[model samples]
Target: MQERTFQLLGLLGFILSGMFFTAAGIKSGDLLTLGGSLVWILACLIWLIPVLRDKDQER
Candidate 1:
């Protein structure tokens, strides 16, 4: 349960940070900011995969 919460937190952070990065990119037109957002998005997906698997396993 703790691990699941951590995973959820990670996902939330990634999404929120990604939005921040996207906003920064839109304001400044920075490639680095966009890249960072992409990285965070990938991390969120990675974290989500395990959670999905765990749910299936539980069922």
Candidate 2:
């Protein structure tokens, strides 16, 4: 449960970060913001894999 909570928090952070960075990039025409958003998306995917694997193993 604790691990799930942490994963949820991480997912939330990734979503928020990605949205913020993407919006900033569009508004400012900055490549760094776009890169940051992409990185956050990758991080989200990485974090998601373990949670999904755990769920699959439970059955």
Candidate 3:
């Protein structure tokens, strides 16, 4: 259950970054928002590391 929550949080972060940063980048007309969003995605993956470790252990 906790692993599931981690996965969900990462997925949610991706969706939010896609929507929010797309708009922010378009409106701002720069790479700043878009570039920062990539970092946001990396952080989201960190949130899911525990789930990934579990999957690796299963194999």
Candidate 4:
């Protein structure tokens, strides 16, 4: 259950960060914000991997 929670949070973070990056990029054209968004996306993917692997193993 805790793992599931982390997965959900990661997904939520991924989505929110994407939106934030888009908005900030459009408004400010900042490289730092763009890079930060990429990092957030990578982190979310990393966080989700274990859950995805477990699900695959169940099949």
Best candidate (score: TM-score):
2
lDDT of each: 0.82, 0.84, 0.74, 0.77
Q: List the residue pairs that clash in candidate 3.
A: none
Maximum-lDDT candidate? 2
Ranked candidates, highest lDDT first: 2, 1, 4, 3
Per-residue C-alpha lDDT of model 1 across residues 14-35, encoded as one tens digit per residue? 7888888888887898988888
Candidate with the larger lDDT of 2 and 3: 2
- Residue pairs clashing in model 4 are none
The digit string of per-residue lDDT tens for model 2 on 5-44 reads 7877878788887888888898999998888897888888
The per-prediction tally of clashing pairs is 0, 0, 0, 0
lDDT score, candidate 1, position 10: 72
Measured against the true structure, the TM-scores of the candidates, in listed sequence, are 0.71, 0.72, 0.48, 0.61
Q: Write the per-residue lDDT of candidate 4 for residues 1-59, one digit (tens) a residue.
A: 67767777769877687778967876898888877777877777787787778878979
* Lowest lDDT 10-residue stretch of candidate 1: 1-10
The candidate with the higher TM-score, 1 or 3, is: 1
Candidate 3 lDDT over residue span 1-59, tens digit each: 67666677767868686668867887888788877776776776776677768777978
**Global local distance difference test of model 2:** 0.84
